[model samples]
Target: MTRGHFDDGALLAARLLLAGLFLGGAVQKAVDPAPAMALLAMRGMPEFLVWPALAFNALAGTALVLGVWTRPVALALAGYAAFTSIFHFQPADPWQMTIFVKNWAIAGGLLALAVAGAGRLAWRGGR
Candidate 1:
């Protein structure tokens, strides 16, 4: 494949994969917000915070998949990933540490996406 084609495919894959991760989280929260609410309560945040978080994940994930406002969406998601990593910041637990680091890694990919933009293959939501 040509370089442009390869890049386009890669970008599309990244968008899909990244969006899928967030969408999955959103689904989990929606299906049983009690767990999220419990977590929020433990953190002293309002239980209702889960609703907004779920909404954000759904919207941002859809935006990435649809390639709408690609750069800005990517940047926002990157920030979200980094910020959410704090929740997994349990260094004593190997699993939590792994997730925390992985969140940072995902944020890195999102930063790259923001720099790269959506390219010609993007749907762009009919701007």
Candidate 2:
């Protein structure tokens, strides 16, 4: 659709799905921080960085879900997804392939949100 004719309902649906997915992942990490930390450690990230990463994931996901500061959150999540793709998914194992595709797809959607704003169907602002 043209920018002016963008479907707000579709955008809202996409945003909600993305936001829920992000929030769920963040909650999973928060609920089991040790495993998340272990995964990060296995990826060679510093141990001290795990908590902050977890917090960012949670906060950014929440913001996206709530349609609060949507552009910034989408941009942050797009960066996070890019990092995940480059760092966590480069090995190209079967399992990693799925994650790589998923991350990139999410990144694409987030980038769209960043460009399009949250749309009129969002809970705040534009609506």
Candidate 3:
């Protein structure tokens, strides 16, 4: 229709895509939390926190997909991304920068969505 409508549509599409990506990962973790936990443990996070982390990811992913508590959910996702990036750091393979970069990129996108409020076409925000 108009420019604003197109912009909102694009924003909503972006948000939904990101949310789907996050939710897919959460579902994978839920289906087999042991491997996710083992990965986290290998990254040096405490064993006790694994379950909580799983729950957080699942809940936050749902929130994002549903456009419920969008800002807070995005912020939480951003925090998770930052934590994961820090946990996955490898000093020897400087060429393997994609791991950290991807996390940071996702974090930035989540943060942007947090600030942008999911736009008007989102499930919760649509006009």
Candidate 4:
């Protein structure tokens, strides 16, 4: 079809994929929050804030997927991802380092979404 239609489709796909990553992680964490909490505690996060973090993930993911106030939602998620990457610093370990890099990459993608927006296919009427 037209270039605009293609771009919108790509944007929609990217938004869905990025949102799915957060949603899946949130679901997994909700299923087993204790381990995540322990990890967060090790990373110096307060025990009281664990549930709030999980809720943030779920709500942010939902908001992104639904394209509701997408730029702001993506900005928040980008900040959260950046904070989480720093919180879990472990540069000496290969797996941890890879994950650290991945987190930053995800943050970058979220920032891009914040700039490009949800496009025309979004529920909130993007264009």
Candidate 5:
């Protein structure tokens, strides 16, 4: 395969990975929202906002997977990931720090996706 083909494949893979993570989290939250709601409460978010946050995660995740409105969706998810990471930033706890770092990496990937878009396998005809 040509270099372009390889690049497209790599981009598609990255998109799938990121999209799957968000969707999986959304599904988990949907299945048992108590944990997620408790987390939000711990973060000092209003109890009412938890449902909207869950819906946003699910819808944006679905959009990412579909590759429609790729750039904006990616940008939104990147911001969401970054925002969520802040709550996990526990300097004294290595495990929590690791999760914070992972979230940052995910945000970075989403930012890159926002710039490059969904390549060659997107519903909006790809980039």
Candidate 6:
């Protein structure tokens, strides 16, 4: 395969991996929202926010997987990752700290995606 082909494949893989994470989170929240709601409440955020969060996860994740409106969607998800990382910032808790760092890493990948566009393997939905 040519360089473009390899690039496209790599981009597609990244998109799939990132999108799958959100999709999985959406499904988990959908299946049992109690945990998420409780987390929100503990953080002093409105429990209702979980609904919109889940919706955004599902919709934006689908958009990410499809490579549609990629730049904006990736940017939004990147912001989402960084913002959500705030919730995981518990220095005394190793698990939370790891997640907080992981969230930043995800955000970094998403920032790259925002700049890279969807590449040739994408649908190219009119742009």
Using lDDT as the measure, which candidate wins?
6
Which residue pairs clash in candidate 4? Answer: none
Model 3 — TM-score against the truth?
0.79
lDDT of 6 by residue, 1-127 (tens): 4457789899999999999999999999999999888878879999999889999999999988999999999999999999999888889999999999999999999999999988878786586
Each prediction's Cα lDDT score?
A: 0.90, 0.78, 0.75, 0.84, 0.84, 0.92
Q: How do the candidates rank by lDDT, highest first?
A: 6, 1, 5, 4, 2, 3
| All candidates: TM-score | 0.91, 0.82, 0.79, 0.90, 0.88, 0.93
How many steric overlaps does candidate 2 have?
0
Cα lDDT tens digits, model 5, 5-70, are: 878888888888898898888788878888777767888887676678778888888887877888
Error of 3 at 25 (Å): 1.7
lDDT of 4 by residue, 16-117 (tens): 898898888788788988877877888777765767887888898888787888899999999988988865578678887887888899999999989988
How many backbone clashes does every candidate have? 0, 0, 0, 0, 0, 0
Rank by TM-score, highest first: 6, 1, 4, 5, 2, 3
Number of the top TM-score candidate: 6
| Total colliding residue pairs, candidate 3 | 0
Candidate 1: give the clashing pairs: none
Q: What is the lDDT of residue 96 in candidate 3?
A: 40
Number of clashing residue pairs, candidate 4: 0
In model 5, pairs of residues that clash are none
Cα lDDT tens digits, model 1, 1-127, are 3458889989999999999999998999999999878867866889999999999999999988988898999999999999888877887899989999999999999999999887667795566
Report the Cα lDDT for candidate 5.
Answer: 0.84
Worst 10 residues of 1 by lDDT: 118-127
